[model samples]
Target: MLSDKERDQVRQTIEQQIAEAEKEMVVLKELTAAVAPDNSIGRISRMDAINNKSVNDAAYRNTRTRLKRLQNVLEKVDDKDYGLCMRCGKPIAFGRILILPEKRVCVSCSK
Candidate 1:
């Protein structure tokens, strides 16, 4: 079990990570809904529109995945299981937590 000081430190880390993740997700949303391609001529072909749509979709999907992972990590923190390895039930190393404050599983469990 972590001491009170350790738990407080983890909580601060969780809050910082959550804020950064939210901003990242917002930027993704903007990119997905970006205005028509900024160029000399407005798009002419339906195919062009489709292609742009696909690109937007891909960006959105990738961003969603990242945001979801961050959200899951935040949830784990709330459970007081933030640093615990999901598979082995061991506390994940502090170094890993510093690298990925929202990571759910330890390196071994991740593999």
Candidate 2:
């Protein structure tokens, strides 16, 4: 079992990461909405509409993936299993958190 202080540290780290991810997702959503064909101005053409739709689809998929990852991390936090190597059930190194805020496996177990 982890000490109280250690658990708190991990919680705080995850909280910060979650906040940043939410902020980024919000910005991405806003940007995507701005570029949506329905909201855009100027002359419209078939090719231009197709191109916009393609870009919108790509961006939406990317943002949704990121959001899902963030939500998964949050669920891990709720389960009190954050910061553990998912593969080996070992404690993940603190330094690894900086590189991968929501990593499920540590360097060794990830290999």
lDDT of 1 by residue, 5-64 (tens): 766677677677667767776776765564555555555654576677678778768666
- In model 2, the Cα lDDT at residue 105 comes to 88
Q: Which pairs of residues clash in candidate 1, taking residues 3 or more apart in a chain or in different chains?
A: none
lDDT scores in order: 0.70, 0.66
**Residue 65's lDDT in candidate 2:** 76
Q: Give the true-structure RMSD of model 2.
A: 4.3
For each candidate in turn, give its C-alpha RMSD to the true structure in angstroms: 4.0, 4.3
TM-score of 2: 0.58
Mark the regions of model 1 whose C-alpha exceeds 4 Å error after superposition: 34-39, 42-59, 72-81
Query: Model 2: clashing residue pairs?
Result: none
Q: Over the full model, what C-alpha lDDT does candidate 2 score relative to the true structure?
A: 0.66
